[model samples]
Structures are given as C-alpha cells and as structure tokens.
Target chain A: MRVENYSFVFAVFFANVFAWNPTPQVIEEQVPQTAFAQLLDFQNAARPEYNAYLSAGIIYLPLPSQSALLTEWGTHNGFAFRQRIGIWLTDNFDGKGSKGITFGLGWFGERQGWDNEDFLFVPNRGNFSQINQIHSWGLTIADSSKHWLFGGGLQYLNAKDESFRWWLLGTWSRFSIMPNFHKGDLQFINAQLFLQARELLGNENSWQNYLPDLEFSFYTKDSVKIFVSQNIFKQKYYLEGAFWARPQDFAYAALKFYPDPSRLLLALEATATKKDNDDIYFGGGITLPFLRVAYNHADDYESFFKSRGIWIVEIRLAIGSSGDSFFALKAPKAAPKEVKRIPMKKANFNSNNGE
Target chain B: MKSVKFLFLLLLGAFFSSCTHWLIDTETRIQVKNSTNRDIYELSVISPGKRIVLVPDTLKVDESSNVHVISWVGKFKFAIFVKNLPDSVYLGEYELKGGSIKAEIKGEDMALKMVLK
Candidate 1:
C-alpha cells in the first residue's frame, strides 16, 4: 500500500487516530499523487487558515448555513484535476451566530491518469496505463463550546470499492486531537499491505491498527501553531505506504498577518516533511472577503501532475453578522474618526484695525 | 475602576493558566456484587494502573456497590478478604477489555472463577 498526501501543512492539525507500525524497508515507493484533501485544505490556495475551531482542514463550529468550494489543476509527472464542495449545516440562516447543531458535509473527487509503473509494483509486470480516480465524502458534526469543539463523523473512501472510516475531532483551548477508528475490510487490507511490504523489504515489522490515527496541536499567540499528524491516504485499490506520516509530523510555524482577527493581509507558513530527507514546504495565502489565493509546494503536486505550486484557489463565504465566529476574517473595524478643528485666528495685541 | 480592571486581569490569567485541566477527568465504573454467602470484609480490584477498593468495610452478604475501575490489558487481579481467611485471596491475572469483569469465588475455600462480562 502506498501512503498518500502527507504533504499538507494544514492537514496535520485535524489528522486522525492511528495505532500500528508498518514494516520497515518497504519497496521504494512510487512518487505520490495529489487529491481533493489538498484543495479543500483552504491553505492550499492561501497562506494561512485562521479559524481556531476548525481542525483537520475542516470546520467543526456551529455555523450559519455556509458553502465553500475549491477546485484546482496542478502538474506532476502528469496533470491532476480535483474539486471539493462543503456545506456547513445550521438551523438559523438569519445570520446571527452561525451556530446550530453544527455539522458539515464535503464531497471530493480527483481525476487523472498514470502508468502502473509510476504508482504501483505488480508481481507480474505489465505495460498498462490506468485512469487514476478518487472519490470520497465526509460528514462531520461537532459540539461547540466557547473554546472547544468535539465531534465524530463517517468518511467514505472511494477505493476499488467504497471503504468507510469513523473519525473523531476535538479542540480544547489551543489543543486539538482527532482519532480514526478502522474496522471491517480496512484492517484486512492493512494486513495485506503489511505482508506485501514485508515481502518486498526483508527485515520489516508487519503491523495493523486496531485503534485510531492521531493529530495533535499546540496553538499559540499570533497564529503560531504546531501540528503533529498521521493521515493514511487510501488510493483506489491499495493503501500506499509511502504516504505514511514519517519520521516527524509537525508544522513548526503558521503565521497570519492581520491587525486583529479580521481582514487578514497575508498568511505565511513553513512545514518540514516527514520523510528521511528534509523537504521544506513554504506556502502563503491572502484572504479577501469571500476569495482566497495561495501558493504551496507539495512534493506530490510537483511529481505527479508536473504542475506548479500556485494554482490552488478557493472562494469561502460565511454569510452572517456574528463577527469572527463562522468567519475567519471579521469585517475591519471602522476607521477611527480623524480629529478636525478649525484654526482660530490669532489675536494680535496690536490689531490692524484699532483694538 | 483601576482595581476592578486589575482584578479582572488576574482572574483571566488564573482561568487560562489551568485551562488544560478544566474538564473533569471522565471515567468508567462497574458494580461489584457480593454473591457469596458470607459477609465480605473488603474487596480490591488491582490493575496495572489502579488499585480500587470496591468495598471498604464489611459488605453485607447480598449487597452490591458501584465502583470506579480501570482495566488494563493484563496483570489485573481481584483480591478478596472474607471473615475466615487469614489473608486476601488473589483472584487472577485476567485480561480485560475494560467496562466490567466478574469474580466468582467459591464460598468455602475461596477458589475463584472470574470472567469478563
């Protein structure tokens, strides 16, 4: 199994539960591919995402009815096209506190083509070109507190057949955790992947998860945060080992530039990769009302699609007056009134006309 | 007004200082039943991480008490000291999947048959 996108700087926070170790010295992995996760991360199109409540590239807060859409095309060995749409559920659309029984739904799809030699190793080698496709959907619901969000959801991973996972997310103060539970065929698939990996690389430990994947964060002042996460990327017919969260899963810095919490001027971030070799990821984004533009360098983005790093774009609008709740950037405070006073004519001891 | 402002800041600081522990330590519990004929002197459940006394004093013959318990993967034992025994009889090194476990002790010799429920 090839591990998928461990490339996102934003996804490390709302990552999932994990408990298992794969065999070491697996076959030299194929260059990775990009998917809908990178596009909807929002940071993929912009520098930084400023919401404290949203974790795992997702929002868990009570929201006024909100809709978000993201689409992108990038170059690697080939070109890849992906799209994502999200609907934040809420009862009151009167635009008060975008707070109801907060839940969200996101649908994502990826379309591209690659040769088996590029992505997989078959026992019997064959020259075959395959249309690599990915389709997945997620449903999340959160219980929101002033400084916390706790919820669980189900995800459908579009593989050879649809595989499902149960994941949970919790954010407290500046700390967040997500645990993913695996059951049914995934465990079996994990075992198969482990055996294949062990066979390919002699001297490797085969392990499977009976528990969750984990993502952790320590949020600090000025939007500087740390994220440690492990996300298992499931491809069409197999689980890729290369995409596993590696040596380390931490984003050292996420900096957003805004006077206060609204009208973010710029967002800047840097993340070190989890692989043995050091690959520094640099990305930044700008938020304008409902529009965002971002530049990011993901290894998969370069290898699979042969695409540049700056084409991820998104438009996110939360229609509500409750400032900074559903929205990351609240309206800028009204400019302070300029002090103006008429200049009084100076009194002269000796006036031109007799005093 | 200045004092008020200072007090407010002080309270905010204290509140945030311990925010990590603000939530209660959530736990799971189990009910211990004394199905044996004799009155129980005491009962303690021993897991790797915890040693909880399910009954502190003389528990009546048929009485039961709800007790907080932590079940580890292994090395989990139940100890019982009854009216006639010289020492507590250790029940098991049982593997637990958490939730609850039952310890059935033969009333006469204190031979125990414990299973997870």
Candidate 2:
C-alpha cells in the first residue's frame, strides 16, 4: 500500500522538476562570479556566529548499540517512516575561542507496513501498524583548542505508550593526530583520533561502553572532500567512507543539468561481525542551500523493505541566520509590498414557517 | 604524589565498574511463570499484525521461561493455549515498568509482577 503511494510521490516530484521555469543552474548563472567568492568569504567569517534553526525531515536509523540492546528484550528491529521535526539553538560561549554549546529538541512518529507474512504471528485483517512515537531532547558542548576538540551530548527520549524509554549520555574527545598538510598540488590530508564513552540508561540497571575511532579526510582545493572513519566499540565495529563535492557555478542560464554528482553525497558503511546480524548501510543525498533530499538503504531492515531492501527518503527545509547567508542574494534589494483585505459585514435573515 | 596516584586508580576502577552495570532501570526483560496444573501447549505474542512464537513450545507445570519482551515504550499482550484446549487463555496485557516482569499463569487468571534486580 505504501509502495503505491511512494510511486505517486516520485511521479509528482519528477513532474515538478521538469516544470520549474528557471532552474537552479539558471539562478546560478545570473549571479556574478565575484558574488560567489564573497559568499564563501562571508560564510567563513560568520562561522562563530550564534544562530537557531528549525527543520523537518524523515529519518530511519537504528538506535546506537546501548539503546538497541532493547532488541534482546524483543523489540522489533525494522525500518519505519519517521515524520520528524527538529529545532536547535547554538551559541559560541567564548567571544573569541572555538567553544560553543548546542541545545536541540526533536519529535517523530513512525509507521510501517507489514506486507511480508513470514514474520507475522497474527496475520489478521487491516493490520497496518505504527511504531512507537518518540520525543527527544539533547544538548552538546564542544571546545576546539590546543590541537584537541572535545564534545559531549546528553539526550533523553520519551516514547509513546511507554513501550520504549532510555537516555543516552556520551562524551567524546578528538585529538588531531595529523594536521592538514600539502602532499601535492591541491592535495591535503587531515587525521584525527576520537575517544568516547557512552552510557545507556535502562529502567533497571545502566551500562556504559567506551569507543575509539579514527577519521581521515582527504580533500582538494576545489572543495571536494573524501573521508573515512573506522570505529570499534562494544557490539559495533564498522568502517565507513563518504565523498562530497561542492556545487559548480554555471555559465549557461538556459540549459540545466539533472543529477549533479559534483554537488551530491554518497556514503557506504559496513559493520564487521561473525553473526548474521552484520549490517551494511548506504546513504546518499543531494544538498542545496536550505534544502535537502536524502535517502538511506539497509540490507537487514525488517519493517518496510524487509529482506528485499529498504529505502528511506527524506525531504527537509532549514532556515538559519548563517546557514543560507552564502546562498542568499549578493545585494539586498527591496520590492514594493502590497496588502489587500475585504471588510467584514454582518447580515440578518428572517424566515416564516407558516407558509 | 602517592595520593594523586591513588585517586587516579580509584577513578579508573569506578569507570570500569559502571561499564559492567548494564541493566539499569530504563531497560527491562520479561518472563513467563506457569503455576497451573495443565501444561501450556503454545504461547504466542500478539502485537497488531505480528505474532511471535516463543520457543520450548511446551511449558510443564510450575515451570518458568525467560521471555524477552523488550518494551522501550509500554505494555503488550500475549495468549497462552493449554494442551488440547479449544480456546486460548488470553493474558490481557503486561508491562515492564522499571525492571524484569513475571507473568504468573495461575489456571485461568494471569497475574503480572515486576522484579527489580
């Protein structure tokens, strides 16, 4: 049933894309070259500014190892459509230093269709179900100084029907094992080691685990970044790699290109384990100034895709002071504003029943 | 210097100890205890469209099986069928509020109790 709906959505999406009058490439070409440079400069200069933002999107990712231990308790591990809304506030505490704190709150409701009867025990009529709705709030503090960066997040979750409940408290510190250096023309490498301790709060007893990870990033002068991370924590050990490239400035206004890989993102991550529970995940996204279209795929997702495969699509719009400053118009231009309203009047009517 | 070393060691020990204390009040498991004279022929978990068959198919009298009913949210229901019984003995619903939950099946009436460990 959901698959049919998804097909209709995709059809509408493509139709709207084709109907766009002046596409993104046309808009890019209208801006002057100098404006692009100014946009990058302004973005770098505003990095430390305080800002707040709100975004809505869909996400289907497994909870971390600790909370996921609920699976041992018989909680279903499956992919569900999550309609999520999130808001965040960030501020640079120190006026001049690289230290800041962020507070965030999010809520999402998830529902999945069970088409496969193999795993169903009831197999009753009209059995489409919804997973637990969750509300979460978190705070993070970070400081990057002396070749070391540290951050910690304390998150709390409340699920509907009290089926699931837990808190995730984690702290991580990163040391710059190798700073960015020029290996060749337009080539650089940066490496970091991250150590973290995550504590999981259950209704009975709490447990904590320590994780150690290494991250390496290779980038060119053209703003294309390729990065990889290797993480080994308790029940999870995975190696992930990603590539992201900056969008190009267009020279032609009339002709537009679809599926721009340069401005797109692709990632592949895998968890290594001897058990059948080993997982491989794929994520991809197309990013614009304040808009994002992303999708994630997993092999072992049980809810919607099940064994065939799972695809989660997300579309979001975000607004912030500095988030879109680089993408906003170069010069501030004002247009005439107009307002129209019709005055309201009351009317009285009389009716006779004798006739 | 000796005091500083002692404190460092104490902190390390505390950290390790906390890591081992995994089952806190937030996560819980469930168990099924049969106190009736008749044996349970089949026990199945019923949630909306899905049903899970608990293993060890038969539960003899006075026998208990550790059933993993992980509830991050709240309560769920199950059904118990006695040997050769035409109808099911429905266990309305049970919740693991803070710790482990035990569903004591006594003849026709099932009682739920929580055990905090």
Instruction: Considering only chain B, report the TM-score of model 1.
Output: 0.51
Q: Model 1: per-residue lDDT, tens digit, A1-355?
A: 1122322432442222121111111111111123323222321111111122221111111100011101111011111122224333322222244544454443334333332111211211222223334443444443333434444455555433445655444544334444444563221111101111211112132332211222222221222222222212210011111232233343233343444322333333232233234445554445454455444423323323322233344333432212133323122221223469899999887766743
The candidate scoring highest on TM-score is: 1
Q: What are the candidates' interface root-mean-square deviations?
A: 24.7, 14.9
Q: What lDDT does candidate 2 reach at residue B53?
A: 60
Q: List candidate 2 stretches off by more than 4 Å.
A: A1-54, A59-80, A92-128, A141-154, A158-312, A318-355, B1-117
Binned by DockQ into CAPRI classes (incorrect, acceptable, medium, high), candidate 1 is incorrect
lDDT of each: 0.34, 0.34
- lDDT (C-alpha) at residue A150 in model 1: 47
Off by over 4 Å in 1: A1-78, A93-150, A159-161, A170-176, A184-255, A263-326, A329-355, B1-117
